[model samples]
Target: ALDQEKKQIEKEMESLNLAKFERLILEKQFRVLSYLIEDKKEKVNIVSCDELNNLLEVLEQKKQRRQDIKSHLDSLNKELACSNFDFEKAMLYRDLIDSEKKRLETVNLSIQQLEEKLAEFERN
Candidate 1:
């Protein structure tokens, strides 16, 4: 009976140890994954779902900015064609148009960069 009791206890301890070792392994995997995430930045493959989501969010913001610029351009174009167009306002809008065009370029560049990053991530 005593021998039987010891064997049962030994079995329980082995099970506990196995559980503890598995927990440690999971912890290590999490730490390593975090490190890889930090190292990858916007480069490629190593990006996790969270980072990809963040990139998607940023892309949405850029797209919104592009839309805003386009709408403003349309408004300005209409104003320019109006018979009572104010020269001062036209000058201001022209300047704004130039800036908006530059902003559009930057937004496009950012989109291109993100697309490239996604492609690289996929290829990996």
Candidate 2:
């Protein structure tokens, strides 16, 4: 279910055509941010003042990317959640398929059991 939701969300994002660019930018920012965060966490003596400032700028960009991706993803999720198929009909179809699958499975199991019994009787 979670995977289905994720794919649905991704499909909607793809339809909007922003997901690709967002993904690309977000990936780049994430990689850069990881490096910058490591730099910031290093011993103060290891990083000069200019390097620290540069790290801060990258952090800011990472923050912005995080916000944008979250907002866009949230909006897409909401839109997908609220969008409707005919609930009654969809549910009916779902139930029908479920019932058919269960019936088929039962029939298959019965056939297997009968075949086993027949084989045993034939061997006797």
lDDT of 2 by residue, 11-100 (tens): 664566555435644444443454345334432422454344444444454345445545544544454456563776445435434443
* Native-referenced Cα lDDT, model 1: 0.57
Top candidate, metric lDDT: 1
lDDT tens digits, residue span 1-124, model 1 = 6446646755665566465335434433443443344334433422455366666665665576568667756765675576364776567557655655776686678778877876766677
In order, the Cα lDDT scores of the candidates are: 0.57, 0.46
Runs off by more than 4 Å, candidate 1 = 1-50
Which one wins on TM-score? 1
